[model samples]
Target chain A: GAGVSQSPSNKVTEKGKDVELRCDPISGHTALYWYRQSLGQGLEFLIYFQGNSAPDKSGLPSDRFSAERTGGSVSTLTIQRTQQEDSAVYLCASRAIQGASKAKNIQYFGAGTRLSVL
Target chain B: EDKVVQSPLSLVVHEGDTVTLNCSYEVTNFRSLLWYKQEKKAPTFLFMLTSSGIEKKSGRLSSILDKKELSSILNITATQTGDSAIYLCSQIQGAQKLVFGQGTRLTINP
Candidate 1:
């Protein structure tokens, strides 16, 4: 794809339900990230994946939130037993590669999936 | 912990006005600072500043990083209605994670 792509632009689920959001990053990109954006809030880093390294899950808010990247391309963010506070836009971004230069830090974002837990 | 902070939570200006957005950060192993313009759901990439005192410009939009102060400023000249959006600043950690600041919402009226 020309840019990062996310599935199910919108999702409405009841509290206690589980929701899975998918992201397909740009071709050949080796780094991917997942973030959460609440109403009137900034992007909250959730997880990061770089090639074969273990994902950095330091930012996951709780045990209910988990994510995995498959083959270093497609990634999935699963929120179990969703609560009202979990309602937000889940964004995915991908960077070309990791390096010491600024160019490697540029991340392209997807349209994001707006999840509403009622 | 790595943190990024942006000032002036929101601003309103008339078209053709110039606006400056500020961002400060305190992060260990800071590799780069980036600016992004988000209108709706997606945030479009703008400038990536690594070296201090060098301004990165894109037409009406320009940005510079001050490594000494651990801050950056994004300047928009002759703004248009289309420039009305949330401007976000983020600091890239050496681990390849980006710590984002609360964005600045800019509204340009015609």
Candidate 2:
């Protein structure tokens, strides 16, 4: 793939409804990441995947937020019983390298899925 | 415990003006700093600064890192309305994970 791609560019769900967001990373990229951005705010780290293992799950905001990656190629972020605060843009990015110094690598980003909790 | 901070939460300027955005970071094992531009949708990569004092330039945009002060600055000279966007700063930690700043909202009026 030329770049990262995401599905359901825009989603509107009622409060407390469960929502699933998907991310398709670039081809052969072994590292993937998920982030959330609220209105007028910065991107907040949500989770990271190195291959099929997630070593850094500390960024998950709460118990309701969870994510899983399969085959080290695609990932899904699931929000169970979503709240109003979950209304934000969920971004995904991938880098070719699995574990490398940040200065030497660059991550390509997806267009992101905008989730609206009504 | 890593964090990035950007200044001037929002700025409005006319086209053809030069603007400089500031970013400061505090993170252990700091590897690189990245600049991105977000316009209405997804963010586009701008530049990445790893070495201190050496400047990276692309057309009208340039950036430099100051590892001594743990900061960086992005400059856009001869700005255009198309340059209007949210400028984001990210301190890369490892591979795909990055700690981002709140972003500097830049609006250029024509």
The prediction achieving the highest lDDT against the true structure is 1
**Tens digit of per-residue lDDT, candidate 1, span B1-110:** 77899989999999999999999999666677889999999999999888643579989999988877989999999999999999999988756777899999999999
Tens digit per residue, CA lDDT, model 2, B1-110: 67899998999999999999999999777777899999976788899887643579999999988888988999999999999999999987754478899999999999
Q: TM-score, each model?
A: 0.95, 0.94
**Candidate 1 vs. true structure, TM-score:** 0.95
- Error at B33, model 2, angstroms: 0.7
Kindly report which residue stretches of model 1 are placed more than 4 angstroms away from their true locations once superposed: A98-100
lDDT of 2 at A116: 96
Clashing pairs in 2: none
Off by over 4 Å in 2: A98-104, B94-96
lDDT of 1 by residue, A30-84 (tens): 9889999999999998888887454588889999998887787898899999999
lDDT of 1: 0.90
lDDT for each residue of candidate 2 in A77-106, tens digit (9 for 90 to 100): 999998999999999988877456552378
